[model samples]
Target: MGLNANDRAIASFTMAGHALVHWFETSIPIFLVVWLAEFDVGVALFGIVVALGYAPFGIGALPGGILADRYGTKRLIVLCLGGMSAAFLVLSLATSIYAIAIGLVLWGAAASVYHPAGLALISTGVEERGTVFAWHGIAGNAGIALGPFVAATLLIFLEWSLVAAVLAVPGVIAVLYGLSAEFNPTAAVEEDVDAGPDEALSLSEFVSNSRALFASAFAVIFLIVAVEGLYYRGMLTYLPEILHGLAAIEGLVVPAGLEGIEPADYIYVGLLVVGMGGQYVGGKLTDRIAPARGLLAIFAVLAVLALAFVPVTGMGLAAIAVLCGVFGFFLFAIQPFYQNAVAVYTPADTRGLSYGYTYLGEFGLGSASIAIGGFVLGEWSLTAFFGMIAAVAITGALISVALLAGLDRFIDTDRSVNANADD
Candidate 1:
């Protein structure tokens, strides 16, 4: 069905927001490579520094969700965009590692609010949830791919600091666009008793609401995403550096005067570009199949891919590139499944809070993988790194199985209760 004018506005606003959030996010790994060379810091220590920023990106989601639930999604999103831009501007002026860390922290805190606010807005406002999510994921993948592509391309002509400053420009424009855009944030949920933002929650009320949320299937969903996050952050954080060191890639020559470009950077971007397809497919599947069932299969595929990554790299560049593309496809494909699962398992009123905890698991606890990946790569082999991430994917798959089983039991019990009542 065609989206109404309001739905179209909401989708457009969110697509832009999702793209901007990921643009900064995916570009950070490129920056990580530069920081290693520029600051001459050890991998483990710098990983911790990077984590300092990402930790807040996930940790702040809870409160960000709370704020979205109180004041509304649009305001929090506007704050997010402005804060992210300012953070990058700060990074442009940094002269030391500590200053860089501070800028990243600001960026994390600002970008942290987006998932909850944007996803909640879509969940509650858009009449067509699945289609919007597909488009949203595609937009995010565009940022994921283009962020590194743009950052790398810019580095060819500009200094790193200037590139950082230039990166801030898009966010400012997005903030202005966000301010001018208009839509009904509660259009889809208006019929529900709990439609729209609510009064501020007291500390006790907050705790109670949280407890209620976790006591249901969402707790399992949280665990699943947390493991997924561990795999995601661990793998992607160091992938470019890992790829840079590969024999095949290292053996390739850059065209003259384009020496600044790393082949690994574009390869990384290519993987993400393929993820746009994965996102579209995954989003569509949500309407056709049980989300947990899809998650179970996807996680299983991820486990195999993770295990095969290192061995496949030995076959040649083409083989590894295909592997990376497939990995990227399934990697992002998991998002819409988990996102839809959150919407299915949680309440309408607490939609913002649910996504907050969802990201808290996905990004917060998952942020630890950054440090873990650094330590593993520093102390161990690429084989070890892939082995560890493979284990994480396996864990996610197991959890998906458990969630599916639980859901089936719940459905059966519900049917039994209805039949007994009728009797």
Candidate 2:
């Protein structure tokens, strides 16, 4: 099914607008650390607060997917952006730590709507689904890359409140773009497919039990992807503190010295950039090479880097940083892989539920990593935490490799038997 001119234009617009939303969300992660400093809150308390901000994303994403499936991707996106903008506006007025939590939950809820809509749009609209998925990834990575830089720059002169208010302004343009574009998913799905609201899962039960994923072949792949999610998020959460620890050990003091750098503070910019670079490279890799092999190699390299993260020096840390980029590249770039794979694996009518399940792996499993990483970090030094991270990456790589291998063996054995039958 070839997409018409209008579909192409809408896809591009949605992609661009979603990029801005991602930038706003991904970059502000560092804000928690900064907010703690600004408000003089306890680190443990702030950790919990930060964790709270992330927790809802997994919980909300499945519901968000359902909304997109039922309501229309475009409308859900517009509403998501509008709601997100409001959340940021709330953030701009916040004074206390609890206010930050309130603002985050609001923003996170809005964020939950985007992935399923965006992924579904890409799946249905694009001819070369992998390429479209890659572009979606690039948009997301670009936003992730830009977020910290923007947030860091904003903090130099303005209050966090003012910064958040200003951040909400871009979403206005996105809302306008969505509204003026004459494409709303909700109306279109009804007109086109005639899907109903009664089919909608009961909200409370849906929210409470969505994480209880059903077991299927596709679901297993999602589980592997979810494990990857845990490593991906876990690695990002602690890399800053880990890198800074290495720098301190190396005595490679910057112009400002140790005080100049803070925990999870100094490396935010580096992490974002690395992730972006990784996605760019990963995009090319996936398009040129098999997604299976590409994912395997990338995860393998990531395992090594995670293992080597601590107990390394100047050149070593720099090398580690670059590998981190590779990790981000393959990790995020492969998102499109799941999008493509799931599309082919599942029937069209139930695409929303399929995509939702995939996200359950990505977001839900990924969220668990925060507490896991935190506990690991507390139990053993950054070095030990990273070792565990490396092990997780190894597990992911093994799973991806095994999946590809099993798929190949099944095909090969089938071919031989068929050849003998013909003879």
Candidate 3:
């Protein structure tokens, strides 16, 4: 079935919201590292500051999910966007670490409210959930991709204070668009999503419906998320620094302190940016292939690439960039697989809580990983940071493989029992 005009409008709003949210969220760090130097904060204090900003996205997931379920996703998204805008506006006035942390906490908490409700909205609204997930991935990656470039470019002319103000502009647009838009379930899907018995958005009655959602597949996905959380938050902390080191030969001027960031750092982050294209492609592939097979293969690639990253420099950085794109593409691209799996295996009533609790591991505990990255950065060298990231990647891959094996057994047993009942 084709998406009606209304469904397209909702999805478009959702997509725009995702883009603005991440654009503001991710770009903060690229400049913050430089910003901290002016305050004379050392590496340890800087790590804590970064953690304050980064950890909240994960921490707020459960509440965000509940909010999505209780109110409407559309409402939660509007509030979150508005809150995020306010937070950034506040950041413009921040002079001390505490003041900035206060702004970050608001931003993190507000930003956290969007994903589960908004994503759940897509799952319910769209006719083709797979394609919705793909578009969701693309929107997120676009935010991911654009954030650094925007941050870097603005730093060239605007003061960091103004940059913070600049980042808030998109949030205002997102909020306005979200508030003005009417949510039509069909936006995310071209099929009969509204015809489902349990499609109603009543959160109060959703308790019984939520339990079957905590399946082994979700547990496996969370294991994978925790690993990637560690890798992404920690290893990515050094991308600009690493690129600046390598780009010396390429004659890219590195950030002299914070003010001198070169085009290559922007370019390197842009490589991760190119990943949206790959993820869009990967999300389409997810619809065609079994997620277990696709996810396992991609995680394996990540383990190898993370290990190979150490020696990767110069043109080798190009190779690293390609693989990094592959890694980010599939790493997140597999999200809808787990999301749809939860929808398929669980009762519709419980999907919200299921999403809420499951994300406790994937998003909640996932927040803790940022703290770990901070710990590592505070205590260890760049080598130690990369080493830990690779180790987490290996751990994630192994956990996924084990989960896949168990899932195979569960599927076989279920099939056998159903066959006997038919007989």
lDDT of 3 by residue, 3-29 (tens): 666668767978888887778767876
The candidate that achieves the highest TM-score relative to the unseen native structure: 1
TM of each candidate vs. truth: 0.91, 0.79, 0.82
lDDT of 2 by residue, 1-423 (tens): 665555566567667766876777675655654675688865445556656666666668777877875676777888988988898898889889889889888887787778877776665544445445556667777777776667666766777788788888888878887788764334323345454533665666454433332322354466677877788677665554455446543464546533433433435566666666655655455446654566677678778777655645344545655555555555566554544444433433344566667766776667777777777765666667778888888887887787678653432222112111111
Q: Which ten residues in a row have the lowest lDDT in candidate 1?
A: 414-423
RMSD of each: 3.9, 6.2, 5.2
Model 2, position 379: C-alpha lDDT score: 60
lDDT of each: 0.84, 0.64, 0.65
Top lDDT prediction, candidate number = 1
Error of 2 at 292 (Å): 4.4
* lDDT digits (tens) for residues 1-423 of candidate 1: 989998899999999888989899988998888888899788888888899989899999989888887899999998999999999999999889999999999999999999988987987789877678768877888888888889988978888899998988999999999999999998887887364477767799888777777666667778888998898888888898888788888888889988877888888999989888888788778778787899999999999998898788776889889999999999988887887776676643454577789889999999999998898888888899899998898888888988778753553222111111111
Q: Which stretches of candidate 3 lie over 4 Å from their true place?
A: 127-131, 185-211, 215-217, 245-261, 313-349, 407-423
TM value for model 1:
0.91
Error at 1, model 3, angstroms: 5.3
Clashes of each: 0, 5, 11
